[model samples]
Target: MLIRLGYEIAIDCPQPMPVISLLDVHKDRQHDIKRQTKVLTSPFTACDVYEDSFGNSCRRYMAPQGGFQILYDALVEDSGEAEPCNPLAGETPVEALPPETIVFLLGSRYCETDHLSDLAWRLFGHVPPGWARVQAICDYVNNRLSFGYGYARATRTAAQAHEERVGVCRDFAHLAITLCRCMNIPARYVNGYLGDIGVPPDPAPMDFNAWFEAFLDGRWYTFDARHNVPRIGRVVVARGRDATDVPLLHSFGPHKLTTFKVWTYEQESYPVRPPARGIDRTLTTPLIG
Candidate 1:
């Protein structure tokens, strides 16, 4: 299916700010199941912007601003061409796992004690098959937690979310990632947009959204335990070991915030490109700190 995605983010600071930086991973990948037809990025004013690729081979863009507005737009075409089934079905389970996936499972900070991993294993014992394990964990998280604002800040961790049993999309994604990793399944945090299903159109944008992706069988599959539904309208900005790696916005120095908004919509009937193969081996220049 072809999709047109638009994303806008605004920050109203009490005072004119000194510096603003953005790390955007909004570009879609040409992979076994999806393709990128057209992509574009433009800032509202004069700013230094550069492109790079991260360890996972995802493309990234960095832009800087000061007490201002930032707009990002991308027109991508994704075909739902399915890839080969994950090869983990019959091989010795240990041999089927990827090295990166294993690292995420064992090395992520979220998998520490008293987190989702501990609770999930205590309740479910051993993980079932790939699909079954994901489904079971999804159901557990959805039933155990309630979605509400004011529970915690954006920086809250998976351990905090597990202790409180309440949080927004980010917390849910973090918890899910930790649980999947504990089961020896590779999972990562995703940042992006999810348009309101009921609200009328506002020229301004909406709030950012978060979800988790799991390496199942042999490929990454999207899951949103926060909504307890399959992925849609998930225009990914970045993917990382956790939320700390893919923040939608990061700022330094003190500045008062007046208002912020995000807007997104889907365009129908765009052109779709064929999937590209082979590892993406390009190196990324060090980001401006």
Candidate 2:
């Protein structure tokens, strides 16, 4: 499968200000499973952009701007390719996990103790003493949660979503991460895009996707509780201990958000040629605030 994605971000600040920086992770990786054909980042104003690879070796772009009317856009094409399974599931132990796994366990601070432990038990009950525990948890989350557009606020936690019995992608991811952490499995929050899931395109609308990553056997594995399956066109932007660590965008001053919108779509054809040269590879350091 081939996918073309377009993303637009606009910020309308309450007052005119100076200095704005953003980290973008849209460059498709050149690996076995997928190929990035083309990627273009457009800013409304003049800005400096840099590229760097972070913890997972994913490419990221950074831009710094001045004043208001901050707009960022990117276009990317990715081909559906399968990657080799890490196979960490067979050798690593639950107690002795990787760094990524450890971080995930410590990041989720709001998951209910009993609920999370129950999930961990479900995943670990059948596992050999020293193996990765992500697949079971992923399956459980996918089976347990129902995908819906509106169930709670964007900032709601896994415990809240579980009590309410409804949640969007982010909520589901959070719930899964919380459970993984509770189980001593490492899991983190991921913000990015999932191409149009048979939805009609609407002008001036917003469509962003959220998922989670579990640290298992020896590496970070991507899991989508909402989709239950993973494939290409799944671009990861920012990842953190929780939602607070990887917000889509943050403002320093008191800026009333007047409007926000996102849209994702797929093209009918695949790329006929390879990617172009001279693609910017500058890394942008994220500012937590």
Candidate 3:
């Protein structure tokens, strides 16, 4: 199936500010692009594109005072299959896990594994380790937290979410990720385009979505605690230890989000074409704020 996805966002700045954006589709999905992903800026400036440490495509440029608008659109192919489910997938012992995967097992900005370690063992210690253990953590998060747009808080950590029992999708991901890390299951936060494709259209406005992935049986698998069901047409943009590492945009100076819109839906007649040349796949040190 073909899915059309992209966004139009604008920010108002009081002065020139250095900004980095993680709005492009992930490096892993570049081959699925049927239509080239093109990014345009209003009051155009030369935007330098690069790859971040996590392998996410990033754009960096100096934002001039006033409005900074960004636009991009693309047609990408999807398998039209629900996220894979493997209840029997086994977890590798911590000592046997790959060295690179060890970082995900540690606590990060939004997911404080240290604070939740005791509770995680208390609530999930009895569950059989491996896929069952991960599912149990998801089940607990799905039940404990109430999803509400109004409850969204950027600074909410996993422990706080567990205490308040309310937050947006990122909170669901953070809490699940933290619990998984505490259980020795490597997990990371992911944000992407998850539209209502094989389901009823939502009444609320569309926005970028958040989910998570867990390393199991030598590979990572996707999981969504907020929905707690297999979903289709997930076009991932970025992944990191938590939301702090993968926010859509980060600026050196204050900026107000003046416009935010995202779209991801089936495009029945999207044409497929060969990839263009000069697409760099290497990571570059970005001008960090």
State the lDDT of candidate 2 residue by residue for 1-289, as single tens digits: 5444433344555554443333355334423223332233344344444442233222233332322333233444455553234544543456666544555666454455465677567656676432335556566667776766756476677877776767878888888888776766667788876664454443424567788876655766777777765555676666677766665555555554533444344555544554444232221211101
Runs of candidate 2 with Cα error greater than 4 angstroms are: 17-23, 26-68, 72-77, 82-88, 94-96, 109-115, 122-133, 197-206, 268-289
Ranking by TM-score: 3, 1, 2
Considering every candidate listed, which one attains the maximal lDDT?
3
Q: Where in model 3 is the C-alpha error above 4 Å?
A: 271-289
lDDT ranking, high to low: 3, 1, 2
Worst 10 residues of 3 by lDDT: 280-289
lDDT of each: 0.56, 0.55, 0.88
Index of the highest-TM-score prediction: 3
Residue runs of model 1 more than 4 Å from their true location after superposition: 1-4, 12-25, 29-66, 78-96, 107-117, 196-205, 268-289
TM-score of 2: 0.67
- Backbone-clash count (model 1): 8
Local distance difference test, candidate 1: 0.56
Better of 2 and 3 by TM-score: 3
lDDT of 3 at 227: 93
